[model samples]
Target: MLLLIAFEAAKSGLWPAISSALFGQRWGDNVVKGSVSALKNGPLCVLLNFPNLALPLMFVGIAAMRRLLGGPLAWAVGLMTAMYFLFAVRYSVSDQFMFFVPFYAMAAILAGLGFVRLSEAGKRRWLGVAAIILLAATPVTYSLLPSITQRFNIAVPGRTDLAYRDSPRYWLVPWKNNEDSAGMFARTAMEQVPPGSIVILDSTTFYAVDMIRRLEFSDKDVRLVILGKDSKMDAIPVGTPNVYLDSAGEGYHEKWMDEFATYDRPAGKALFLVVWKGR
Candidate 1:
């Protein structure tokens, strides 16, 4: 359904703006990495990737239901359904229910359980038939869904940055996901930043890139700063040795980059890596 909506938004030429709103420059503006890492490491990632693997999971869910959820198929169904929804709260908080992928995965898991329980060979055969039919109909249905009428809307504009900067969900986090998230921001700065200058990220991808990729940041000149939950200064990160993350403000105020580089931030560094050789 996310793909469906994204495709529809893109087809209608609202995608870039929607992307900006969803996770691009707007909401993601606070984040540094692409979340490529966050999506890989933790529970938030588990749910992020859940939709992609939903198909085969259906079969697995049904088999597990029959085999594990008590003796009978009905009992298994009840258990799996109840348990998944209960567990899904974790996923929901991470994803903030901004998209539909998680819900779809849970639905597929239940369907798979039902397909597995049909003992009649004919019933099993019909299940296979239904699966094929639904698979085939998906594109048709996607094609028929309405075009995007409105672009993405940021529910909480302040929380738009990546999870690292604000940790708005920190109260619910199982542990320190912010460390990696903060590193991700640093890594993103190292990427687009020219050597020996500061870099600023306006998207979440800044804090979400791969770690191996971090070494690519070998040039020491790059220094990046993710915005705090609140902006105490009217500033920006642009030009050589200076980067900016200012969607909420404009008409930049200049500050000596070196002044901020030394400040300590528990979330992470307050400025860029501060050592690199720009091209």
Candidate 2:
């Protein structure tokens, strides 16, 4: 069910690609490999039981360590650590990576089962669960994680006056990426100009929206700005660019600004707020 929640709202490439973009890093497109593996897993999950992922992982991780010898176990640990670090480097775990939570759960079970033994019925149950899981995964993953945008493309109207999504109430982007506020790097400078001043984050619409709701800011005359400037997101709304300030940079470029616009601690970006320069 938790898997399904992630599965339902899934977006592909957004996480992996965006993370790379934010960090000025890059990685293998991996679409071909991604597609192939997803396809292969479809059959595997279907043939086996749904693979009650979390439950088994908790059960097996400890049990396996107990049984495996020091030599091979140590090697396995080393290999896993290396891969994790590699992914951390050029690529990273992003929201899209959440899509893999269930799948990883499945993989974890496979690993644990390898070292520790289960009863015949336990094995059968596992397989049955794996099959059911594939059944769930096949359609859910197919709908959520597609190699191409066309796979999960949702049609939208160019403009819809009566649309609920267009309403100001709904306009407050609630997602992390929704463009609502100013970014951390530029907010102080923009705010320094005066009240009703607008500086844009150019991404993270929800962050911008949150600013409107929490601060005395308004989204009424929201304009778009793109997140392309040596800044974060290439494009964003003029009235409503996703801008915020972070303490990491502390007025320095590329610390919090040091890296790229991302969630930071001690201080974070403030959402885009506007003070009309023209009016």
Best by lDDT: 1
What would the per-residue lDDT of candidate 1 be over residues 1-279, giving only the tens digit for each residue? 345546757666676645443444433532323344333333343342332334454555555664645667547455545443433333212353344344455557655565565533346665677667766665454333222111232122124334345333332233453436556555544444456443344444434432323566544544444445222344433223344342222212123444443322223333323321332
C-alpha lDDT values of all predictions: 0.42, 0.37
**Model 2 lowest lDDT segment of ten:** 155-164
Q: Against the true structure, what is each candidate's TM-score?
A: 0.35, 0.28
lDDT of 2 at 214: 44
Best by TM-score: 1
Kindly list the per-residue Cα lDDT of model 2 for residues 1-279, writing each as its tens digit: 323334433644446444442332333454222344344443333223233343454345445544554657645554443333233232322223323344454445444554244533267576567746855665454333223333455322112221112322222122335432243323333333234333333243335433543453343333323333443433322233233332222322223232333432222223322222332
Over 4 Å off, model 1: 1-77, 89-110, 116-126, 139-197, 200-203, 208-217, 225-243, 246-279
Per-residue lDDT, model 2, residue 76, is 58
